[model samples]
Target: MSFLQRLTTGLTASKIGTDRFGNTYYESRKSWLGYGRKRRFVLYAGEPDPTTVPPEWHCWLHHVTDAPLSEQKRYPWQREHQRNLTGTAQAYRPPGHDYAGARRAPTAGDYEAWTPGG
Candidate 1:
């Protein structure tokens, strides 16, 4: 962080909570410019990846909730939070994707192509 950021955060930010990933959330101690709500922010434990934030904390960070939820209750069918892997090796690739095989089974001959005049 820059010197300016350190100073501002030190002067204005107050610790709100920490997430399971060790990220620390904060909100401003006072209203910003005395006109709007206090600012909210996070200090990432490691690399600053937004997707690392869990849903409950995300809601609090965005001011959707006044406080972080006490716990993240998961339903039996719910999957856990996962970091985005869009450009990484572990990202999802369908069977016909170029990185997979680039080939899909031929479609069943059930439909005919529509011509411009037909």
Candidate 2:
């Protein structure tokens, strides 16, 4: 949709908040087309990965929390947000992963197959 279309539908929308990942949230308390559900929209960052959303914003996005994270007090101990790394070069790969082509041979100690009542 063009900027004008989005702006028109959400003319009453107030900026909700933004996360560190560059995702922006907007919400309109008013109902749209008599649907009676609050209108909420998200302008996702670069590639639109769902995992990029933080817990606080995630709550608001799903209507779990009506108050935005920006309106609440967050502690410093909370860990930084991270997006899903699967399928990327940064993805985790075990030592025996097929793509890595490096498998470790199991030794006697590693072969401990359990037998019932043995």
Candidate 3:
């Protein structure tokens, strides 16, 4: 963190839960505003990419789930949550992708072409 951010947020050493792919979140026991009251704040150690968080962790972070993954059980049919990166270059390209390998058929002569002089 920069000197200005540290000074403005008044953050002290925090308890780290996990660190993955340069993303680390910490819980502070000190108030961010330094008003003598402590509030839990999750800070992204690196870039603030929402995809960095897994589904279970995302639910916990948003308070949607009361229990963490460690305390929870997964159903047999439940599939793991995967980040949606569609519309990007990394998206899935099926066999008939028009830009990749699909060929366009020649135009049919259903209607005569219009000619100004004819």
Clashes of each: 0, 0, 0
Residue 40 of model 1: what lDDT? 90
Tens-place lDDT digits, model 3, residues 33-82: 75544443355556555676755466666556544355247699986545
TM-score of model 2 vs. true structure: 0.65
Candidate 3 local lDDT, residue 13? 45
- Models sorted by lDDT, best on top: 1, 2, 3
Which clashing pairs does model 2 show? none
Considering only N, C-alpha and C atoms within 3 Å, which residue pairs clash in candidate 1? none
Best by lDDT: 1
> Alpha carbon lDDT of residue 59, candidate 2?
81
TM-score of every prediction relative to native: 0.78, 0.65, 0.43
lDDT of the candidates, in the order given: 0.85, 0.76, 0.56
Q: Point out the higher-scoring one by TM-score: 2 or 3.
A: 2
Please provide, for model 2 over 1-118, each residue's C-alpha lDDT reduced to its tens digit, 9 standing for 90 to 100: 4699577746678777778788888887687788667877777868878888777788888888877666346689866566678899888888788877779667676977889999
In the range 1-118, model 1's lDDT, one tens digit per residue, is 5699778878889888889889988898988786489889998888899988888889998889998987767799998778899999999998889999898667888567889987
Task: Indicate which candidate wins on TM-score.
Answer: 1
What's the CA RMSD for each of the models?
3.5, 5.3, 6.7
Q: What is the Cα-based lDDT of residue 17 in candidate 2?
A: 74
